[model samples]
Target chain A: MMATKKRTVEVELSTSGIDSQGRPTRVPLVVDEQGRPVPMEPTLTLEPDMKDEHMLINIGPQHPATHGVLRLVLELDGETVVRCVPHIGYLHCGFEKIGEYRQYNQIIPWTDREDYLNSIGNNVAFALGAERLFGIEITERCKVLRVIAMELSRIISHLVWAGTTSIDIGAFTPFLWMFQERENVYNLLEGWVGARLTTTATRVGGMAADIPAGWTDGLSNFLRTFPRTLDEVDRILTRNAIWVGRTVGLGVMTAEEATNHGLSGAMIRASGVDYDVRKDFPYLDYETYDFDVPVGTAGDVYDRYLVRLEEMRQSVRILEQALARLPDGPVNIDDPRVILPPKSKAMSGIESMIHHFKLVMEGPRPPVGECYVAVESPKGEKGYYMVSDGTSKPVRWRIRPPSFVNLSAIPRMVEGHLLADVIAINASIDIVMGEIDR
Target chain B: MTNFSAAPVGSRAPRDVVPASPRDVPRLGGPQNPSADALREQFGDVVPRVDVCWGETTVLIDATRVLDVVRWLHDDEGQSYDYLVDITAVEYRDMERPIEMVWHLRSLPYRRFLRLKAEMQKDQPLVVSSIWPVYKGADWLERECWDMFGIRFEGHPDLRRILMWEDYKEGFPLRKDFPLRGRFSRSEQLSQALAANPEARYSMEELSIVDAFQDLPADVRERLAGGEQPGE
Candidate 1:
């Protein structure tokens, strides 16, 4: 049986009145070096043999656009894709299998590596999962801190995104601007977390420690300048003839297609959906903060790009709001089961020291229930599913890594687009293979 | 790697405190049970029994009926479970049943999700969920199910080793019964061979048993202890 054909979600302009001869006088679909759709010459025409029989091209496992280790088998007829099959598990280290063996705290560092670019987000997702498992509550101060850290993470992740995506799409100015902001973010985060990429900084109930002094001022300065730099990128790319020509209507997805595919984050927002986990399902005090969910009319590579660019601005707005309300109380949950006693107390009291040693040697166990806790990361809804058997180690732990699901939609987005546009569409989606393959 | 070891693979199975079947577990007629008449009423003759837990209703169906139920869950009824959320497995080894295949379905329409399970024996298990048809997302999840657990998705377009390199005959490593490691038994076989022949395959010193005890060829006979290559 033949499968139903879906609509094109790639961004393109509405048709203009044709002049005289009726040869698609305005802009039409572009074709590339291999005759696939190109931004300049978008068309879906098949070769003679291709017209009769389809061709299947496996796009990744090594292709640059895949982000990391993902493989896509694209069955095409000339440039129009007939079917796209994704082969995953190339990076499945059996993380779920491994989680069953280690203590609850041992799993925090591992989450950081899943989405290396958004380690704070990954850490919080796990942190929230354990918090839910034990029914631990966070103080108002920690809630504000979470908002600040998560917002900073979102900005940093998107900054890397803007730079790396521009790097991919043959643009260099925006690349420099985005990276300068990223370097500032890196300095601020490192000052607070000690390590950068795999910072196991966020413990279960609260942060690892209090924020270093003056870090808030540094973050505010970064947030204040970020919008101007973003404006610079916006002025350069949003209206530039070539930039618009290349991205404005390329690799579009619509609301229906995106919803059906379970697309989320800026990718879905780019296609005009109004779903933001932070807003729709507010956790970690997001509802208290004021921010907007950026939406786009077209779900094209360009639309996704604009959505993310706008999202970074909104994230900055949130950071500024959170910074104003930054609290000064204890950050970590004070539960004896989840946290170690104070060193002074441990030194004076035998019970306190024994409890401290036990907490360090063997982590606290969660109850025998399964819970899947999700948080909105810069990329999308990053969630962790934990299964406990009344033990310190989890019975099973599975990551609903957004990259894994998001990468599945690549072939559909790039199939008819020009090969060069493939890079742009991939960058707009913002996938990290470590998370994808995990 | 393991901080704590569990019962051996061959040891007694883990037991579940079997609760009384939810009034919904419809009984069929024939010892070779035919379709449950009551079940056919709520759902069609083919519609499987739907069970509810935590407000989420899981529709248990035969693997052959996967396409129909999945299609109904997504299109025919607008559940728009158009999104294939996740696919994972469960091992029921210590129980009377040893294996269960789980498919987690999510519907963007209601923002609700459901879990489906196909209980099967360890020997031969079969299920037909043509992923390319339902949520194109299931294509990879289905491949992974086959790759790690060796579960077969009957209509899967492409099924092959996803993680382990080819030529690996070891059983699905995730199966509770599969050995955590397989090296120990391999050494026992080598030891028995050495007992039979001190020079098992051949001594490093000998070209051949004194059959044709002629001076051994340089290639076959041992040279120096550690001096190294002939090129030297």
Candidate 2:
């Protein structure tokens, strides 16, 4: 087939406003009577004039301000954010899927990694859920030990949040001061669990081991010195004019908004919601402890910072009370089905040896049921929903990660605020990527 | 005596009730609260079963009217569950209706907690309207349920995957049938792509920058782009 000649059409270009150099002629800047430069109107356009077009900008998958691999696509008009779409799962490791195949006690290490900064709290939350499922009431000593460990972890997690938030907002000195205290807390943890960061410190029924000799002495010393250091950092950042200016009126969430969004811990308390799991649910004998839950009126970054600082103080109070009431008993439960027997007994008797072997190999078989338990973790309510199937492993192990839920409110918090305020708002949330993407 | 009936699976014998400690703040609401009774009366047929397990009340409702029940619980003046604590799904592959969706709702004012669950067919895992309109926190949670268990929230505004990537096409990883080891391996996928495009510029082995240009001259990048072997 012969090819027909290509049809061509002559298209006229709009050159009326063109200069001799073939560039669009510059429109003179419009000015008010006072001589301030005003924006010029468009001379040529195909589409109708919209006042402001939104430009989409991506922040973090690697950004320092995000505190993790959280990627947020921000739609901006000028410098104010119009909308924010968060893209997560860059750090997803299928923790829940992996828990399905692992035995009950074997999943403690997984919880440790969920919130690396607050591993002990995560461990305690998971253990409490499992114990509730098995209907095993722990001993008084175990309860006191768990309370101490959880409060210590809460202090450490909050210190990290304080340091990171201060650093994000351009105050570097508080970070160093707070990290010094964090290092001390980590040393205290290392003494208890033999690990620093990911301390799988607690078991299903109790602790991995009882607190060693002199552990409380060091904790007491920390309790004394930590408050002074916190007060110093508080003086440095809480009243600094720049800190107040950047955070005071930014990202204010009301009580109703916070409750509807399911925020927990300081996120909700800062919004004036007086709900604390330690106080309300009263597990682990928290009902006996004498400490106040701090609530704030204005739910802004500055308010969150204040609430977290007050919570650390309250944690110190709980630590002091728990230390005073430290009981003398077996840390682990007395049930053979839950805790492994002593090596001496196992070696002396065949039945005990078989029990030990089965306990170590197959793990504890919880009853077929489900239970949901939540604790006041450093970030928020770190909850675990475990469904047992009369087997060694859980049929479904669901982690209600507080960071995942709290981070969902970032878009709502950052809308209509300046782009720079995103850092302050995100820092206020203080999310851990491991938990959010787990 | 092998007494299996002595202690049931999920039951605990009543212990001595500890008196309220001196430091115990009186609960905001009374223990004789009638929220459970109110729920039972309001949604009579919708909630077929109400179980008081381990001192926590859980209402088992039909999947068709889950939205109605939750809305009633949320909007009802006496039993307002203002806070939506958690939402998740559990898979029981052997059961007739294999998927169970669990929701934990808490009322901040009353200091009360309630768990609501609805069962869905394993093959058709569809739930009624999304609770995002009522609770904004359900946005990511509903997406997570859909990602992990393939449970569809019918009226969700954005129903895409949250924890998994957009291009992920494997079976839902949280389902019982999904293998412990994932269905597709990243290394295998890379190798297959390299095998399919052998004549293309880069192979799987050379995808890394350090491996692709180790100890090569500055001009080697240009030479390799011209289809010339760098080492030669």
Candidate 3:
């Protein structure tokens, strides 16, 4: 076949280069047969100069990426965040104010709602603090059981954090995998505590009930199988190029800054400060368990991810040790003031019936004193500061919520990063607005 | 190679120092923390009372010298309480009793926990020096304390309400006199919420950052400057 003659038109380049927004202002156009350049489909209009002008944007009091009712007002210079102002309290129920009215045991349910992901952990923590105020030592079995509950709570919290964080960074597979493992853990919690999310499984001196018969088999199965899911997630995300690109250099807080800002849990440990409440200040025999506290050097979002992942492994190790050392004894203390008599005894003996009635009607009272007991919660150093005026109800009850304090440092972390990076940094902090607003 | 798994250089906690749970801790008057003695030696009369409860030491300092004591504790090489665990205030049920401000400080290296408290009389202005200068973490803590207990931290950069909206009119919710149900009736609370402008969710400082409210009329600006109160 004969080749047709090739026809080519020489087109001139655009006049101006780029606009303020870095978009090309004009493009080359083809000419008509008369060598007259055809008017380009009306030249692209240049965007107004936005160089020196700043923009204000609000994220959410209801947006999903915020994790809960956390609103952030950000001022942007171009695409970079100049300043960030976080507005919380949409979920505020005045947990502390209500605690002053209810008895110690009644306050356990309130703790569940604050950091709902770690409800069982908060129960253990509140019970520990109240027991301290009442000046009572829990049974040895109770201590070991509380340790198991705390470790399990930590696993649940870290899984949720990882799952939601993965979703935030545009990865769906890890979220599903992580949450499947979380559901398994939740099932274990349900078997033990009878509730999934709000497990008020503790009393002032003991748990609500001892572990049901053969419950250890379920826990042992979880301990054996949960890490395989974690390993799968690590394989999917740990070395992912996109994940590393989005998180490696974002929201860096040096050790000094992290410590000064009161950032805790995986946040500070990611910054290279080896200050774990479990190791630095021991409680509930956390020191007795043999497990490593994961520390990271970068202090960035990726480091936080790595730290939390390692923490889950460490939690698994602690759970294994706790399972091996599980003892046989009453979970509640022997003291009659706090523990109720047997139902048969109360029905038969008149004195036992009166004691039961008085104990039920009037709550146990602590002496005139105050105590602040802090625990290594999944979020960080969760403390409960309580004061007694020799009354059935506490004079004052305060929750030193770690998420609240950790979230407070968001403005600093998100200041210089891009607008999209604010979400990554916020997710890395692992804030539960319930705790912050409470 | 961003040191993802690498440990920190010169980490705060040493491997040799192993912490154990406190067993058989006395109900009252246990052994005192070393920092307590050091604080007494450093500022003899400023620290008037030291009490031990549940193996935790509480050192009461004069209200005026809190900043001084905290700065010393932070800067002094010997007593490096670099981490501020928490800052909260407690009001006793007895109306006559003074309110107490509690500061929980931890020295990561020394493995010490000390509680510093300052008491303010009910009649007093309830002003205490802010520790934000020493620890930046004190920013929201002091703000929350003021928001809840109505105790002012004199020099916090942004001393506004944290857990509550800025223009909340009901008295401090955590005060002993504040009712459990709240100061206002349910109907009143509902009306207030309905009347409140959703646009005012952004505080003046935030709005002023971009001058977004500059286009509003003078009366609105005056009202906003007057503190964004509805039905004024």
Candidate 4:
């Protein structure tokens, strides 16, 4: 009725909601009966400092140094860190929850996805956790094969860091050279485990399948040339003044501070802690191997960079030894309680078929006890704490992801440095988001 | 005296236990003698009793004695589980005492380790002296236990959900009682069903694809209508 003086006004506030399937559904500002905030894709809001005591810089959940979905709320003063609050779980895949429902063996696929960069290491860690808790010994052939795979994984992980870090720090040439080697390792893994980045081949008590023939000899050739390739790259960067300037003394942390921040693997070792799980908590024939744990002089980004580079050479050394000591034995444990009877046993025998069915549907139980097993992962010490209530599924299967812990040092490492240094620091730490947020 | 081989995951049956590589030297505690009795005697105030079973030693200590115990193990001046290889928790919700905190520790100098079990009532389950202070790696390990099983490490600098999203509070998913099937967002299941059956009819389409086009926004309607002759 009143067309006199009218003006159209629109207030837009977009929000998200879940559809019937939990898929994120968005709404344009829907209000409830009570007029409260409805849940949406998890978001963070900085509480405006009521006191105005300090300035805050939000560093991630998207920033490059975070390596993944990690968000760090850093309180800083003139390039120096006053406080750092690390918030995680952006990439939380509910892996442990997934493991709870899955049969012990069914979880191998998920483990590969957690530490996607080092599937071999993940497989080995999980396999060892199962074996230690169940007292099932892996066969010699399987152990050596696993060793070959894991050492290769360690090398691949370092190569990725080298490439990614080089790109992060303004050097593009090393990225290509390093990725060339990573691609070689990936192709070899695909042949061995049927997947490139995520190999779900390592099984409890043994591997999921036997090596696809000539793997040992094939990997040996790769390992032989790997050193020369690394050496060629090293000649350019290891002692390069520019490389040292960006890394050395940047993100400096002492052994005490590193340990305090829960640094491990190269992060702790680079700080002069001298800890390597392969040497500390031997797993899967590691006791018989020969290699050195390279230690860093400073706990700084440069030291971490050095530690990982040296560690790659050491992993190659271990690979050489594994090749020479390859042994022949059953790959999977013979026990029906753990490893399933071969298909040959199942097709004809009713009992074997039933056993297979039960194993698939119900799964085997671990003894009523607890075991914590830590193995050297490419990132650091990837440990699994498995506890059984004597049930088919584990009462608890927890993974101590090295990337998650190592990345915690980011705020400390980059507190006073330029934002650009964050990428350098992230590369130095070698944080793999899948593993970190797992 | 429990010697997990002081063997770690592999058991060589004596004859096969070859000398460890430098890489393997620190395997399970760097070759130091981490006997339960010796640990008990060393931290008489911390370790009340130690039991060696299955070649692995489990140490029993009063909840209050943990700090003193770890002080002895980590910085006891002689033994340093300096490298925190790993830290984890155990939930014995069914035990007579219903204990929940068990810390596995290793001393690199001696190349040995022991599992410390601190029994506490579930309602007020608490323990002191987490290995986090000594080993940087234990920070997340302790946090994981806290997140999954509701175990707490008193002195951890940052203790919160490490895996589950910050807003999640449905019950610890790792607990024995948490159902595997349920607790998923309804939308999650719906989407999964939809993904599996991509051809399933949508509500608008069920109204008739021709009629559904009328419900589209003017812009989207224009784009789709452009795909065909209206009369056809």
- Best TM-score among the predictions, by candidate number: 3
Q: What is the TM-score of each candidate against the true structure?
A: 0.73, 0.82, 0.89, 0.76
Chain B structural similarity (TM-score) per candidate:
0.56, 0.66, 0.82, 0.60
Itemize residue pairs with steric clashes in candidate 3.
none
lDDT of 1 at B176: 61
- All DockQ scores: 0.07, 0.17, 0.36, 0.12
In model 2, the clashing pairs are: none
Q: Alpha carbon lDDT of residue A84, candidate 3?
A: 94
Tens-digit lDDT string for candidate 1 (A1-438): 211222333343433344456544444344444656534424332212222644546667787666677676665566666565566556756666666677888888888887888888788779877776765677778878877778888888888887888777778888888888888888888999888777787787787766899988888788778788888888777756666677777778888787766677878777776666675545786767767677777778777777787778778888888888887778877777788788999899998888888888888877655555667888887777665667787766778767666766776787676555666777788988778766
Best by DockQ: 3
Stretches > 4 Å off in candidate 4: A1-55, B1-35, B42-49, B85-87, B92-99, B125-144, B151-171, B181-232
Instruction: Estimate, for each residue in B1-232, the C-alpha lDDT of model 4 and write its tens digit.
Output: 1111000112112333342422212112223235566676776766676654334567788887676676667776566655454555555436455555677666654556677777777667454566665566667777877776677678888887776644455777656566665467789867865766433432332225446456555655765567844432
RMSD per candidate (Å) reads 16.7, 14.1, 8.1, 15.3
DockQ of 1: 0.07
Tens-digit lDDT string for candidate 4 (A327-359)? 777788788877788899898899899988888
The per-model lDDT (C-alpha) reads: 0.67, 0.82, 0.87, 0.70
Those runs of model 1 whose alpha carbons end farther than 4 Å from true positions after fitting are A1-66, A70-92, B1-69, B76-82, B92-100, B113-132, B161-169, B177-232
- Cα DockQ of the candidate 3 complex: 0.36
> Whose lDDT is greatest here?
3
